[model samples]
Target: MKTLLVFEYRRGKLTEANLELFSFAAALGAQTAGVLIGAETLLPAYPGKLYLGDIVKCKDYNPEVHADIIMQAAQKEDPDYIVFIHSSYGWDLAPRVAARLKAAQVSEITGVSEGKFETGCCNGKMRRLVRPATTKAVLTIQEGAFCFTGEAEGTPAVEKLEPSADGAGLEFAGYEEPEKREVDLAKAEVIVSAGRGIGKKENVPAIAELAKSLKGELGASRPVVDAGWVDHNRQVGATGQIVSPKLYVACGISGAIQHLTGMRNSEFIVAVNKDKEAPISEVADVMVIADVMPFVAALTEKLKQ
Candidate 1:
């Protein structure tokens, strides 16, 4: 099999999802090529033909333009499989690539073997197998779903590409930098989440200190995020980010269904609330009922030992 990976860069490097997709591609034992579109001072070593470019450096993004850039490379490379990471860019670009090539698209594919692909449904509660009818396939992969294949043997041969995207339907607008993240919550092993039960923003240190003692990342519920107690990036719930940490500590969370859907898959759940009847109790492996502040403070003090 021959594969083409369209990579999106983050901070002058391949995004984590792109790296993971590359790992998946390498494991398929297929001949692989890459088309990277961005300006990056440094690139990780890859073991394939790499068409690196900076065409979008000064233009507003138009999916048609990106699709054309990809297609120009595709015409030269003629890959049997074109792969993308299911990111904001991927959502826009994949369909265009698929339509132009008149190929079947297997989206959010989590696993692939023997020409069969696996995907998740119902917010990852159920799995389904997909087999494309076409000889060639265009795939978009979900983040964190695939195991990374080990690094390739040597650096890839790099070539420059100069495909231009004509601004057809969109124009460049002003850009705003996103909020800086305090932590990478998705990679955290343990997470301590605060909900409305935490009482006030000033009392957050009591819970945060406890999370610190446990060597866990501090997460916030929607209310906590809305109340300006934490950055929106640290918010965890249906409206926020979904997390699946090794240990999930729910501090004063009422366990709304929206929040539950985001974290129900966590390996171990420990719920703490003054009200034992809270919905969170249903999913908790261990439940603690008490005034949240005193307990958090005492636990924080104990963990100092």
Candidate 2:
């Protein structure tokens, strides 16, 4: 069955989630097609036939405009499935598209089997949760859910289809660049994440030391973000950056569903929480039940030595 894949290119590069989605769509017996809503110049190489259309331009992301463009593509392709990566942009646009098309909607998908989607949530601040149902549906695959493969036997043919210049009354105002930081969590090979168990803002130094020793990025749960212990970009959860690093060491995180939904796909998950029964422990490849500060200090010293 043909599947329409919605991908956005930013700053002249395809988003990582789109690459993962393309890899997944290939495995699901779907002939992939591409869609984008920006300057066509931004998209370098699309794997499959391109749905050539000029989306309504806005200074920043406009869900109304984005949803309209996707729905417009859906009418033309009428493919068996539509997919997105459950990122901030996807969450904004997916539900609207699903509602307009009267199609099933699935987000934060971890796996797919027999056309049924499996999903879970993970955030350190809240309790665990699971999505109980799945359907032959429109899905926003979780960022780390699928391992992306850039290799293809032959470069997929690229064709651009015309889209009429009509959408909700929205026009491009201008552009602004987001602030840059020293650490890019998305590319971090190792991450040291702090949770409520990390105690106070003062305790974060221990974790930071550990991260420095390990040459890793420092991450935080939503509470730490809300507490202003770190920059919002440093938070890792449903609302934060979804990271799939080679090694993720979560300290004092209880493994809320929203949080887990983000990082459960890591290659190796190592968590240190006092509660062994904490939901995070269930998915952890290595679990250590201990106090956050002492563990961090000890681990930092051991690594340094």
Candidate 3:
């Protein structure tokens, strides 16, 4: 099988998610090639062939033009699968390329089982494994689902192509920066996340205290955020931020698959929950079965002392 990875470059660098794409491609046991519509300097030491479209000519993001560049690369590579990182960019561009190529399109793919792609369904409460009925397919992988650890064997062979930028109805405008977030959970070395098991919003501070004692940031599961116990920016789950802290303490979290997918890559995990069979226990390095408030209070006191 041959897989083509569509790399996204932003802020003068390749997005970190591209590493996960390499890891995904490696799992497929296929010949892999990459394409980027950006500066050559932004290219990584990919192990496979790389197709570069100069950013100067292509300019800023225009969905139609970028899709055409990817199409040109696809024509050259003739890959069975064209893969993207499931981000805002992929959400917009993947379908367009798929439509042009007349290929199957799958989004938010979390895993591969027996040569089939695994994705969430029914609002992430269940998983469904799917195989494309078409000869070619477009895929967008869920962020943080795959970890890249392997090193590139050698420099990739570079092929330069000039794709047309004309005929796009959309005009290019200067990029606008998103509003600064109060907290960037992705950079936290340690994260203490609260779940619905905390009982009530009033008890949220106790969890925050535990996180403070650990010198870490406070994170929340989707339910806690939805219930207005925590801000949306602090949420840690499939619908929230994907984090891989050095240490993660999941409090009252029952380990829903959506929640686990976000923090399962933590170097070490400790889950405090009353239920021994909570799904979080499967990925946790230490599972503490105790009342949420008491356990958090005790741990905070111990850490402070």
TM-score of each candidate structure, all chains considered together: 0.67, 0.72, 0.76
Model 1, range 204-284, lDDT digits (tens) per residue? 887777888889989988888888987788888655677889999998898765577578778999888998778788789
Model 3 misplacement above 4 A: 122-125, 165-190, 196-200, 212-217, 221-228, 231-247, 253-267, 272-282, 288-305
TM-score (C-alpha) between model 1 and the true structure: 0.67
Where is model 1 poorest over a 10-residue stretch in terms of lDDT? 54-63
Cα-based lDDT for every prediction = 0.78, 0.74, 0.87
Between 2 and 3, whose lDDT is larger?
Answer: 3
Q: What digit string (tens of lDDT, one per residue) describes model 3 on residues 164-240?
A: 75736887686776556788999999999999999999999999989999899999999999999999889898768
Scored by lDDT, the top model is 3
- Model 3: how far is 21 from its true place, Å? 2.9
lDDT of 1: 0.78
Candidate 3, number of clashes? 1
What's the alpha carbon RMSD for model 3? 4.0
Cα RMSD, each candidate: 6.6, 4.9, 4.0
For candidate 3, the TM-score is: 0.76
lDDT of 1 at 41: 56
Put down candidate 2 lDDT per residue, 76-166, tens digits, no spaces.
6777778888776777778888887777887777777666667764433333233324333577877766877675333434444444333
